[model samples]
Target: MTHAIPVPLPSALVDHHAIDLERKYSDGWGMKVDDVATTPSGEMYTVSKIHRHTYGVDDDEADPARAHFGYSLISKIAPDGTPLATAVSGQSDLARQDTTFGGPTTGLGEDLWWARGLCVLPDGALAATGADDHTHLLTPDLTAVTAHHGMPHWREDDGPRDPFASWISTTPAGRLLCTTGEYGLYNYGDLLDNILAITDEPLTPVSKPTLRALACLEADPVKHTEADLRPGVLFAGEPVGMAHRPRPSLTEQLAKLDPTSRPGDWYNARLGRPAVVREDLFVVPVFGHIYRSGNRGGPFAFVLVTDQGEFTGQLGGMDRYLDSPFTGHALEIAADPARERIYHLNRYGLFAWTGSGDLKQRLDLEDKRFKPLRHFTLLDCTPDGDLVLTHRTQHLLLRIPCPDTLDHVGHAVENALRAYAKERTDLKKQWKPVTWHWVDNTAPVHRL
Candidate 1:
């Protein structure tokens, strides 16, 4: 019996890869984002700014200063300095809440309503399975909306709705498909619902003009009112982030490379695992690039064997260019047969985004140069409130000298700082500070 050597596979999915989508909506017309509460974990219980109140102001605040509705279920705020009953927290009866929040105009038809496992279908419709154990659909042109609870599942008896198929996709024949690990699930019907969520039209069709419109009917004021919008027939509200997405695609070309006379290639391992150079198995067909460390966890020196069996590894990261900590895209090994150079186009960040769906938001995985960062458990403050940083992946943990600023972090924590600087250095000059980060973000997944 013999084993195969393992290799790399190009993939769309990556861990700790966070991107921010600056949400833009249709200029006017909005909804009531309301509700309130929080968990002991310090996360808020309401959906987004829904709990925001018009507090500490004499008149209506400017829109930017106003509590605009962002992604539903986006965060959990632990009020830093006051009691929950304060009017500013939306808990007091005297608090006035603002409901007006939106973006520029009609285009991407998907208005997120507690959606999860959002799969863009082949025909441009969106298949959104939500936390509510139900899936919803919206037309690409933003013309229709439908709710679906009947997508087929593996197990039938009322067990808690399997979160597995919460994600969806479609085949070339337009067949609705979803997946969990290795198995694909199919949706069975056109099961539709009366969309009461939001209306692109101002009023229900049977009634007259009651709501404001961008283009109001002049000839027949009563007949052509925006009020023509009805409960069941409506348009998606101003979408959040890159709310409109295209269907996800896999690297089907890899199938040809899969030398499995055993028939189908291992799609599961291909999508979920990282590239390796082990003797027992190679997922991809690239030549082996073997590397070694001087000591335990020291620098890795590699021998790059191309298709021609050419090799080079001593200079990979051994003696020079030692400042670059291997992380994210910066860790990838590449070849330049033309320049005769074997180097990585590696940049900083925990992970690199491979999706073309949201281009405007090119997330820099590393934290900003001079910004303050705080995370639970991993990077937190001590009892006296000193800033403590812990490296989860590298098993390194240390506290900085000053609790409030990144300015005081000196050579005492050089290893962590080196890794952090490698991640923080802006490789791309166009790196823009995120305006509003809602996509592939940090909030808990239950709010997904």
Candidate 2:
């Protein structure tokens, strides 16, 4: 096993930051980071927090959402794994704590819920969401900018539904998207502003395999705890909660929908979570089954969301679309605006695809035995083509190759990234680090 020195967390995090995650997993047992993000302009940040009542989520009353105790810590780090005292040069959690600005420091318990969003804005600023229905935008230099509340995340109708943000990403033009981990994938994002009309796009049929996966999901409650088996809703549970499986429940659900309606449609709108922008198309993962398509040893399909914010179709069957990290879960999918392509993390590995049905590469962990040990959920890519992954595990946070390089990923990947460089002249130009003076190119692949 590969062992590295454990970086200690702040006393505030270990002591006063009393939350459920520590009680269950033991404080400082490992890195324990929840998510990670890096900017093409040489800035990187990590979302580290132990969620409140993380495993105790059940009913609203029995386990009141307010009873949950969770707080978030956003820390900046250098590409070489050194923790920077600050990023963009401002105090890390000060904006949230300062009530002088009428900011609910706690943010409606944003960290109290399952997820908090992090993204670098188009103009080089950082934007993060709060549980209190607020969006925090920090200038690229780390100075907090207060006017970003103008960027409302949810639509008018979704106000009362409590749209929880699970994942977020930005467009080149600065448009923002926020998705919910709360079942039904309620989208109260800025993308809704361009609304033409509530989409009436025909629902794509849930394939036999997808149906079987759902059937199995209903059969095994633990596979996905978010399943709700009510008359119309099946598996729409909150972030902390899990649904019980009833064997005949799937059959009954099919009977309730319009005969012409597709199950995929219901899930697209209801089970929306984790979204990113790709040119004109908005993409989201279809949580129809625990293992949609990419859960196995190789290539799998991902569900796409229509511009209308409804799940429209699936993108699969392409070159380089191979390899999965075994959880069969495609946790996060991020798009590269420069190349106009998409990529995702499955357990311990990473896969990329060119928008034109050409998959780029599948770079996985060196030790296959450790594949099961990885938590590949948190993912985001910088405009310069570097992918950032930060998530929690027993030993906590670890970058692909110690925060600075991915050369440890082995020979095949190195060659693929090299060949990918030559795929398009613009791609070559974009990968050039000098364009962004701050970008680190000390690694071997960087010199390529």
TM-score for each candidate, following the candidate numbering: 0.23, 0.50
* Reference-based lDDT, residue 415, model 2: 38
Predictions in order: lDDT: 0.24, 0.38
For this target, which candidate reaches the highest lDDT against the unseen true structure?
Answer: 2
lDDT of 2 by residue, 1-448 (tens): 1111112244333333332233334432223455556776555665544333333333232322223333444555565444553221111122222121112342323322222566665556556654423345544444344332321232323333322233346555544444322222222232211111111121111210000011211222222222322221122231222343223332223324236544443332223334444645655443333335433433223545443334344555432234443354444576666656666666555556555435555555455533532543545666665455543443223333222223333443343333323432342254432211112222111000
Cα RMSD of predicted structure 1: 22.8
Cα lDDT of model 1 by residue, 1-448, tens digit: 0000001000111121111123222332122222222222322222222222333444434443443222332222232311121111111123222322112122111223333333344344444443323444543322334434422222233433322223233322333322222111112122111111111122111221111111100111112222222222112332111211111112222233234323322221112111112211111111111234322222222222211111211222232233232322123332212112222222321111111111111113244541222220112222222233322222112233321222223222334444444433331122322331112222223211
Candidate 1 has its poorest 10 consecutive residues by lDDT at 1-10
True-structure lDDT of candidate 2: 0.38
Q: Could you tell me how far off, in angstroms, the CA of residue 211 lies in candidate 1 after the best superposition?
A: 42
Considering every candidate listed, which one attains the maximal TM-score? 2
